[model samples]
Target chain A: MTPIDKNSNMPPESEAAAELLDTQLDAALQSYTVDAPSDLLAARILKMAKATPQQKQTFQDIETGNIRQENVLWREKRYGFGIAALLLISLTFAFGTLNFAPSDTESDTAEIWLEAAADLGMSDIYDWVEGQTNSMDDTR
Target chain B: MIYKADPDQDVLTGLMSGDERALKELMRRHLDRIHRTAMRILGDAALAEDVAQTVFLKTWEMAPNWVSGKARLLSWMLRVTTRQCLDILKKKAPIYTDDMPDISDTSDLADKKMIKDDSAKMVRKAIERLPNRQKIALTLSYYENVSQRDGAEIMDITVGAYEALLVRARKTLKNTLIRDAEISTERPKDDRKLAL
Candidate 1:
């Protein structure tokens, strides 16, 4: 125990009697142990403390429901994105099969090229251009 | 904020605020002594464990209402555990000597082991045979290391009454051991003893 207070200057007889009492008490208490608790007692009691009526809501209680709601929101967003991506892919495929994907550049360039080639022949190309411009204005 | 200096108050505040860590800290601080008190009084490992758990649960429930400064938390715990053990003892017809742990020393040397084991066995039996009040007083004051004043507070008795209980307990235990020693001197015995 705390070194028996060296500075107190107790008498040797009293000290000896105290030592004798100590020895007797120690012998009597040899079989008794202050070590009866279970090793996991703190953990078990802490777990029990959770179920106490005073604990309004534990973190796990709040996190569990919130996590489920987050999962639902995440799932809805994923499903919406998946359907939109599928529709976009399907529309692209439909356009490609209908020949619209290649038609704009290929067909327009072909018409321009054919018209330029015909104009290069120099056979009334200016007259034909004027006639085409006049006909477009008449139609308008 | 609960100051760190006052751990019991800290834990009480934690209990009020639903802090499990505080509960764990309190359990670590006090459960060993509480369970030791119960085990010494009841002489049963399983029942002592149950009693220790029940005492803590009761403490947890009563935390919100526990007013500091009226009594030390440890003294209160002692009272609760003491009452729970006594209640269990009252319900059971006779406390079981079989539940006493073999506190005998088993050493390498044969003679030393024999002497130690014999003394411990006799002492344990004498303590076990004691009346409930005497047994509890011995368990609290001697084994639990509780001071006489606090022991009396736990027992809800006066200091003189507690001292008287300890004196009577010591006398009874001495007489029981002396009687057993006389019987052993005139009798045959076997070292190989069944636990039951």
Candidate 2:
């Protein structure tokens, strides 16, 4: 971009304001130096190289494309395991039918049924029915 | 040795080839600037050291792909250091009141450069008082001398936004300096010395 002209018919007050700013900025810039620590470039390059994959140096262009692939694969592996575990838990809950009865209900009904059935002797009747059925079962 | 044309590239290539000495060379080159940038942004020597160390570690980790034009390596490092400092700033909201070390007031190159001076410290404190984006713009323009494009890259803002921030920051800093000048004029020299 070309240097902006502060004077050329640019609204007078704005132009003056711009000139004042340019002056102050020049002063501030002069006072400072963004020293990149002369040693840092080599260090950073070495550091980045060390940090980079060997495949990257040997194959810079290929590595560029592979880097994204590695990230995608890493993400897939992480979520893949999580999804697998989730599916396993869901399947177990869905397929594993369970039977349960309250302890109080079982005990309460057991005594009452025993007392009521004493007069009728349902067990004996069941045994007698089983015996007669056994004798006649072949013809029937 | 490793890709022999450029020494810096050679060292980096060597490091990629697992040559340990290349690591030392790389660290030597950037440590000071990284530390200084970190110090300015963080305003704490210890935290600056940590930021510097982390930037180097990340650099070392990213070495193999240090392709020449992917980014200006130093600016990339500065960007990393700036980000680390910003993260800390977000958590602590540090207020810098002290002067930065080795900052000089003399614009003349011939003058003996002052060491561990208060002027830069005041300036740095004043900079910290700026809005976050403005502080970044000022630092990038004044200290880093990064062109608008590189500055935008470092700050992750658009070039237009970066320019706007710089303009706003410049205005704010000028107003602040003018205010300070007025205040100094009203105070006696003895009072100024006492305040310092």
Candidate 3:
């Protein structure tokens, strides 16, 4: 046995022991081997690659696709808003036109016209109006 | 000096053009190494195969824009395999205890054969008992014969850190084997010498 040195951390014997241990470890690692991969592994991988879609390779391609998608969404939204606005305006116009009522001034003017016609005793005008209304009813 | 064009460059060009033959050729060239590395790290043949398949699929997808001369494709694949194996080991750390089943079939064998088989089994179990990073370090440095620099790159650590991991792995493995030797009466002296 070799004498142990107090100052040095590893003596010569311990160094030799460490080397021997490393040799044994190397030998064991060399001896430990796994079986080869199965023959079907490559074939299976090929089949999977064929079935799956490949991703876009470049960042440029990915960015372009994203921009196109965004453009389509923006177009859809713009058309939707335009159509909605058009519908709202049309509904407003239709409601206003259908629900119109005669104003008080117009009603007074019509009453005055009626009184004047009565004072004039316009029987021919009345007769002509009645004849015209009868003709419209007959046509209907 | 004859400038021999890299064959992998040709394969990369073909893969970029969506050639199935190129993919097949690539697999033929590197699949065994990838599978072996994965198997040694994971200790499961099925999971190793899945990892190999996934790595190749990623290769196919990335081949179109792959730049030449940055790093060797095989090195990249090995790095991916290491990462995949680590992920798996982390997820199922509890299942890979030291008392896991032995790999060798020792039934109806001669005494000498049984002894050799037992030694190999003990070595394997000792390796499997190591932590995930240490196991990977040992596998890369010893079994795969990967250079320390390359191993560091694959593991994404500093060279000093990689060396430290490998030293720890070897020391741990040696201690475990010595402990097993003291516990087992059936291990022959010569077999013990060979294993540890």
Candidate 4:
């Protein structure tokens, strides 16, 4: 191989062969361009533009801010129901204890029975009993 | 060459300007081409429809950025199409096809009309089989007539890298097409060529 100096402006004879190769390459590349779908590109593009405007907006809403707001609302409602149930249960228990449970106690029943006995005084009961006994003895 | 304000650009500009009629006109104009490109890349009509839909929608989003002086709208669409093909390539295993769709006939057309026939489909199949970057480089260079520098920029690769990819892609395509030609002697010819 003849070594050409790097400073030479003219390339070696191999440049001619390279040019032939370039032409062949260009022809080959040209053949591939035969089926470019230039004719039908517009219609397809418009269809795409119209397809998802409403849906995309809806999706963005659901995925971003609106979803968070909905979740917060749901959580608040659930917590409110939970607290209300707890308060209702506590009030029912407290009211039941004050109104109904004392009547069930033995000490309260005993006090009521002693109060009834005191109303039947001791002297009146003895006099009535003696009068009844004398009448029974005379009949016999 | 001065850019022809093709129907695509008209529809794009019209849609951008918020004309509803332009949207319908746009769909009418490019659906078949999108379908064809998708079918070529994916080898499945259903999948092609999906890719075409995606490409069109993306184009709508991108149309505002496309000024006429920058590039032909067709070339821009081709770039978008090829990029979409590359995206699909990255996400899945490569597709294989024994045959390709027949080209529309151009017998009554001018001599300078683009070549179409069984060979075109074979080339498309071979191109589809290329590695992602190589296929992309080849598609933009061939289909869009994009210069090497421009193709490299679109692909976000160095010019040398793009050239290398083109070389490999061409070699692979040539090999496959030659192999297929040897095996299929009784290939069918498309009858409805000039009519379309």
lDDT of 4 by residue, A5-81 (tens): 12221243677644544454455445444333444455545555666442222344555665545478888899999
TM-score of 2: 0.54
Score residue A77 of candidate 4 by CA lDDT.
Answer: 94
Question: TM-score-based ranking, best first?
Answer: 3, 1, 2, 4
Worst 10-residue lDDT window for candidate 1 chain A reads: A1-10
Q: Which numbered prediction scores highest in TM-score against the true structure? A: 3
Alpha-carbon TM-score of each model against the true structure: 0.56, 0.54, 0.63, 0.44
Order by lDDT, highest first: 3, 1, 2, 4
In TM-score terms, candidate 1 sits at: 0.56
lDDT of 3 by residue, B1-196 (tens): 1223445887888887889999999998989888988988888889999899989999998776676777767778899999999898979785554343433322223333344436666677677778788889988888888899889988999999999998888877776655454434344445444343
Name the runs in model 3 displaced over 4 angstroms.
A1-13, A60-140, B1-7, B94-117, B186-196
lDDT tens digits, residue span A39-85, model 2: 44455455555555444432556655545555787878989999999
lDDT of 3 by residue, A84-128 (tens): 999999999999987895566668788898789888999688989
How far does residue A76 in candidate 2 sit from its true spot (Å)? 14
Off by over 4 Å in 1: A1-26, A55-140, B1-7, B94-116, B189-196
Over the stretch A24-103, how does candidate 1's per-residue lDDT look in tens digits? 44565575444556777767777776776762434555566644355688888989999999999999999888985445
Clashing pairs in 3: none
lDDT of 1: 0.69
lDDT of 4 by residue, B1-196 (tens): 3555554665767655556576566656666665665565555555666676776676565554455655656556656766776677657764422232333323323321222234444455556665666666666666546788767766767899889888877656544444344333212353243335
